[model samples]
Target: MTNVVLFSGFGSHGKDVNEDLFDRCPDLDSAAADILGYSIRDRLRADRGAGPLDSPSNQVAAFVVNAMKYHAHREDGLTPDIVMGRDLGEYNALEAAGVLDFGTGLRLVHLRAELVGNADGAMAAVLGLTPEEIRAVLRSAGLHGLVFTSLNTPYQSVLSGRPSDIARAEEILLRAGAYDVRPIAMGKPFHSPLLAAAAEKFRDALRGTTFGRPRIPVIANCTALPYRQEITAEVLARHMREPVRWHESIRWVADRFPQAVYTAVGDQRLLLKMLRQIFAESIGPGPTGATSRSPVRIPSY
Candidate 1:
């Protein structure tokens, strides 16, 4: 049987995915190079030298979605039994699933980054804390602006809000017997009400966009469920400002694909680490273990 694979990450571009795929199939480098162009190569190199190019999700989505199409055209088609994403990665999965065309998906992601990039905010990883404990701390501190942006795993979650509020919330979480809280380097607060304006702008952008029923199942960030045919661009637009239900979505994947191998495609291996932490006992040893693949860092193509 073909080993089922589950792919996910935040805002990792096509070049990234292509690079990862290339590692598995080295002879495809020329074809990948041809499709990605010189600009992509330069960008990828630069990204490697410096840190990750913040929010390349849209560009990556456009490339990978199209690359899959190109592969489909060539008969050496790319297909995954299940595809999913978290936050910006959701757009990638949407494109892979054929819910949103490449152009529309990329456009939406770019606009999303621009809109959310302006806000002053902060996010932090709260390790060794349950979601309920984190929520209780936020509530007790009267920090109304904070939101639990990511439920990555049972012991790990991300909290996002205005910088001041997040700082305060960090203290509260630490005091409540949490292991540690460290700030994330993201520029804006995502998956919170703070990005409501951006969501509206995204909704407007969606009007001009077209979406077809997906060829594969697409797990949405907001709902963490397989998208129904009735879900429109407007519904996806609303996801921009809403919290990502990553934990539930991952649970869905685990329950559905008990024997599947998960490969997290993106710059940072954050999602991969979380998966290991969450599914520790269930996975076996070695790289191909139920949870074994090393975090694949796709060169920014």
Candidate 2:
């Protein structure tokens, strides 16, 4: 069976996830901590009580945790045929695909996080609303500033824009029969036009960096597909400014590799949960471990 490794972005949960990873991979963990100016364990523990970390520290801690898990997987002699990372996790996938070195990727992530964190915007999750429905809400509400950030599932989408616009959209969605409308604890809106400045800055920063074609196909969060050409500064820059077609990307992978074993990586099983939801909505529940359209199944790490 094809082996696919799915890396989660931010929002890694569980009390012991960071602790266990820190214990397992001390060296890389230490390096990451040094770069971030705080221990990931401390940060995670604080985040448990507080809300999510600001973009910079959040990206740094998540990247380190992802690296620790990835190293542990390699130690167990596990490898992947395909690697997919969502949002912040994309940097991890690039490292896995041999397109970027750990140090360089981490450095870039730090820079990206800083630029994005400094922006003035907000994001919120709208559940029980289809992509079209949400778009309609934005149009009907005249929320020109608000935009769909991520299509996490058939019935879930994220809206991002200025704080006022996002709040307005959230209220509109709630009144329109959304199951839930929750704010995303982030310093800046991601994957939205509000980040246009950050995207442009990041693109310029990427010009000085080096990148190679991935060893395996790496599906991008921005397009929900494999890179059409060489991944360049412009491509990554555009990614920062576009919506993440997560559901479409996962479905594409499932359809392309029907027999692939989709394994969620990192500290939690959020990615697996989302994948399962997507499969259920798209193809309906099938046999215990089978998707309706394919034998592919989402397995947790």
Candidate 3:
């Protein structure tokens, strides 16, 4: 029975895990305060009260929530065999698997947002269109700055590029029969080359940090493979300017662990929702002979 623990990226956090966690897990709460130089709980509250959280708020909240949840799950005797994270969520995954300590992870998260700053480009989700379709739309428009960044699910993909180009692409996609093309509220055009400077700085930060091998296996978002420890930092830094191959990452997990039960411990069940979509078709051995990923025994409990 493989237990794959999932953590989501920025912009997905809500008021899911907050003040309640301080009392439930005092140790974690204290650690957060000690490392962050203030109470993360207080930050969460203030950030929420301020209305929609910015990129920094979402990043902080996502990590804090997942870290607390990981510890709580441990106390409940639920240790993961594999830890996987999506996009920015990989920072917490590294911490969960012991590749990085709490202090390093939290500080890195903060630094990541700081370095990326506010992006000049924009990101938008084009639902009901495969990544391939979205790319075709961009190409037809002869847009060079805009690029597909995240493949969230088979049918949903996120694109990041110039705001004007994004607006133009939205119109084109809608006309092409896209179910919905909504803008994602983010300060950074994550996973896009526009942040090349930020990515380089992030790589410098990564080089300075010590990345040990994970106690529990951790699947990386960029390569959809286990972190090489020594090169994991490079992969993480590249993620800033490259696409998050999420669909492939999930497929990699399912193919390896047929009885895998994916448990999402983050802002919400974003990863699980994507997982269900990936497993939607009862994929199995076809008439050709070999089996594709499907009929997964994802426990419903």
Model 3 TM-score on a 0 to 1 scale: 0.90
What is candidate 2's lDDT per residue for 1-301, written digit by digit as tens? 7788878887653345736667888788777766667787887888888876666777787787787788888787667888888888888888888888887888888898888877888889999989888888788888887888888889988888888887777778889889999998874678888888899899888988989888988888887777633665666898788988888888787777776766677644577667768877884562234344433334222
lDDT of candidate 1 at residue 262, scale 0 to 100:
53
The lowest-lDDT stretch of 10 consecutive residues in candidate 2 is 292-301
Q: What is the lDDT of every predicted structure here?
A: 0.64, 0.77, 0.77
Candidate 1 has a TM-score of 0.76
Among all candidates shown, the one with the greatest TM-score: 3
Candidate 2 positional error at 270, Å: 1.6
Error of 2 at 231 (Å): 2.7
Report how far residue 156 has shifted in candidate 1, in Å.
Answer: 0.9
For residue 166, model 3's alpha carbon misses the true position, in angstroms, by: 0.4
- Those runs of model 3 whose alpha carbons end farther than 4 Å from true positions after fitting are 281-301
Cα lDDT tens digits for candidate 1, 201-280 = 87887787778887767777788788875776766776877777777776676666665555444543556666666665
TM-score of 2: 0.89
lDDT of 1: 0.64
Shift in Å, residue 144, candidate 3:
2.2
Clashes of each: 2, 0, 0
lDDT of 3 by residue, 22-135 (tens): 687787778777766777677667766777676775687677777877777777777788888888888888898999987788889988888877568789988888877877
TM-score of each: 0.76, 0.89, 0.90
